[model samples]
Target: MSKRGWIIYNGNLYTKKFAEQIKWLRKTAETFDFEIDVIANNQLLVAMEEGCARILTEKQKPDFVFFWDKDLFLARQLEEQGVRLFNPAKAIEICDDKALTYLQLANHGIRMPKTIIAPKVFVSLEDDSHLGQVIEILSFPMVIKETFGSFGEQVYLIKNEQQLRQKAKELQHKPHLFQEYIASSYGRDVRLNVVGDRVVAAMLRKSDQDFRANVTAGGKMYRYQPTEEEEKLAVRCSQIVGADFAGVDLLFGENDEPILCEINSNAHFKNIYDCTGVDITKDMMAFIKETITE
Candidate 1:
């Protein structure tokens, strides 16, 4: 069996660093006589359609496909055609949906922050069946999050009762989640980078006066050691979510219990590298190569 793979990415492949990853993978793959292809979205759906169709017809197709969010429709179409996806479509879907992640984690006894889901078009506060539950379990200064939010951009802090109600009123047509703000995270959270079943590295992110510690939000990160519990949680989440390499976000609760925030299906490695000096891409690619060569 020849070792071969493909990487799906956006037009950002124009950057040298992006190409380096593909180049490195290809070189490493050649040791096993593997062929690798990198497809970018610059030419629209051409790469997706051609790639997906070829894999179905060609006997010598890419053994593994690593994806980084160019288009979901394209991704799904390829998977439906039986292309071997790195993180299966189902796993990506679970990680993308906050409500689903919570449900899965809770079912498996993984501790996570308190989360509440409201329909996109929530008409009124009193019209919620789960409103009572939120009121009972969540207190003021809670966090209102958009389920599909990324880079900590769509997170809002509802500092007072009025702000929560006001934002809720404005978002009558949009879906959202209400999570108990563990004021303890205090604009800081732990992100554990997991590669396959092992944790490559971990870091603690701190935001300024804000509750969200995402690096994009003027936040700083420091080195961190994943506690046994955190490491287990990271591995469990990676296995369950099917992420080859990802960052698992967690924070300490009032009781010092680890509460999961969310898991990144396609995490940003630059931040992790700047903080921890770990080159996660090399390890991520190594796993697939080793598996294919084996």
Candidate 2:
């Protein structure tokens, strides 16, 4: 019998971009003779009874799940029921939160920008006095990022104390972090898509208009050839985050060295495909098949 699987995505995200990713995965599964079903994360109800958790769904459980959504609770519940997740719940949890990702990478010999995780505040702060220490560490022209964001949407570049205080106050009630801006890589960065232990594809994203180089932020993509060091770093970061596969973004340090930017557990490959013509879904499906069969 053919192996059965599922691709779980966020149901609330109704966009062609998301739909295309699911379509690609399903199409790739056909080549491997794997029976893959697409399901929304919210469609399955997680139930807890008698100190045990179970998924209440009419659909039959599969041999594995390609968890493309960041619903960690659902992912964990499925795992509790003995369903293997491609990127495990713990991995997704760590990658979903920028603070968690950075904390996990700390002391791991990963070269990243100097980052200071903001303290969690229950109530909004009335003044900018709390940002005194942050300003001392990472001065003007720094970058601020929300803990949970994608496509570089919740990232900000603070040019002065005014911008810093404004952005900090805006995100005070939310989880965020401050980091030194990589001037060498101000408008450019490299994205390496790693499957298993290898980088399957890479692209350099550049934006003349914005500090962030994410494609969704109006950046353009081009094929990139990563150095040995860059490739190793991407793979290592993925391993550290416990991700089976990931899109690792690398920033150029002052001396052209690679610095860790961020890792995406459920990275979108459409732009990389358009730029490099490399279909990541194929490698992803192959990896899944090999993992489940073995």
Candidate 3:
């Protein structure tokens, strides 16, 4: 019998890019003789009775799940039922929250920008005195990021105290962080796609218009070769986050050293594929097959 599995994605996001990603994975699985069924996260219902939790779905359960969504609740419930998730719930949870990602990386002595997580606040900020300390440490022209964001949507580069105060007030109620901006890597970054213990593909993203080099933000991608140090750092960061596969973004330090940017648990591989001509889904399926067989 052929191995059976599922590719779970978010139902709410109706976009062509997401659909294409699923298509790539499903097509790759076919070559390995693995039967894959694609399902949306919202399609499955979770039920808990007497402290026992289970997933209620019309579709039959598979031997494994390629969890491509960040629905932590559903992911954990699936794990509880003894279903193996590709990146696992814990890995997704950590990568979903920027503060948690930084904490995990810091604990492991990973090199990254100096970051200070904002305190949890309700409603609005009653006092802005803490901003004084944040300025003293990070100074002017700092980077502010929401703990929960993707595609560089919630990231900002504040040039002065006025903008900082304004952005802080706007995001006071939400989880956010302040960080030292790496001027050396302004408008540029390298994204390495890591599968298991190695980097399968890499691309340099650059934007002349904005500080963020995300492709969604109109950045251009170029095929580039990573140094040995850059490759090692990307792989190590993926391992630290407990991700089976991830897109590891690295920033260039003052002397061209690689600094950790962020890790995407369910990284979209189409852009990397377009730039590098490497189909990451193949590597992902191969890794999954080896893991399941082992």
Candidate 4:
């Protein structure tokens, strides 16, 4: 019998872009002669009764799950049922939170920008008590990012004390981080698509309008040839984060050194495909095939 797989995505997200990616992934898996089903996360119900967990569905358990959503609970439940997830549940949870990602990488001595996770604030406090220490450490013209966000939408660049204070106040109810800005990498960064300890493709992103270099943030991408150091760093980051595949963003630091930016367990690959002519879906399927056999 042929191996079966489940490609899980967010059901609530009704965007054509997301649908298109799923189509591409499922089609690629089909070309590999695997019977793959694209299922919505919400369609499957996770249940726990008398300390026993089960998925309340009539469908048979799959050999592997291609988890493309941030639903950590669902991912964990699937793993508990003995279905292998490509990046694993723990990796997804860690990468979903900016603070958690930094904490994990700190012990590994990775070259990331200096970052300070904001203290938890239950209520929106009126004063800027926490801002004093943060401003002193990161200074003005720093970057403030929400703990949980994507596409660079929740990241803010504060130019002065007032902007920092205002942004902090606005985000008091949310988890955030304060970091020193990399001036050398303004409006520019490199994205390396690493699959199973190897860099399949890379692109340099630049923006003329926004500080964020994410393509969704109106940045432009071009084929990039990563340095030896960059390739190693990207691969190492994936290993440290325990990700089977990841889109690792690197910022240009002093002397053209690579500074770790962010890790995406389910980063959209459409743009990378357009830029590098590399089909990551095929590599991903191949990697999964090799992994499950071992």
TM-score, every prediction: 0.83, 0.97, 0.98, 0.98
Candidate-wise lDDT, in order: 0.74, 0.92, 0.93, 0.92
What is the per-residue lDDT of model 2 for residues 220-288, given as tens digits with 9 covering 90 to 100?
Answer: 999899999999999999999999999999999989899999999989878889999999999998999
Off by over 4 Å in 2: none
Q: Over the stretch 148-259, how does candidate 3's per-residue lDDT look in tens digits?
A: 9999999999999999999999998999999999999988999999999999999999999988999999899999999999999999999998999999999999999999
Task: List, in order, the clash count of every candidate structure.
Answer: 3, 0, 0, 0
* Superior candidate under lDDT, 3 versus 4: 3
The prediction achieving the highest lDDT against the true structure is 3
Candidate 3 regions off by >4 Å? none
**Candidate 2, position 183, lDDT:** 94
lDDT of 1 by residue, 18-109 (tens): 56655655565566555677766443352346444422333344577777653666667667666677666667777877777787777787
**Who is ahead in TM-score, 1 or 4?**
4
Model 1 ranges off by over 4 Å: 12-34, 41-60, 120-133
What is the model-wide C-alpha lDDT for candidate 3?
0.93
Angstrom error at residue 20, model 3: 1.6
TM-score attained by model 2:
0.97
TM for candidate 1 is: 0.83
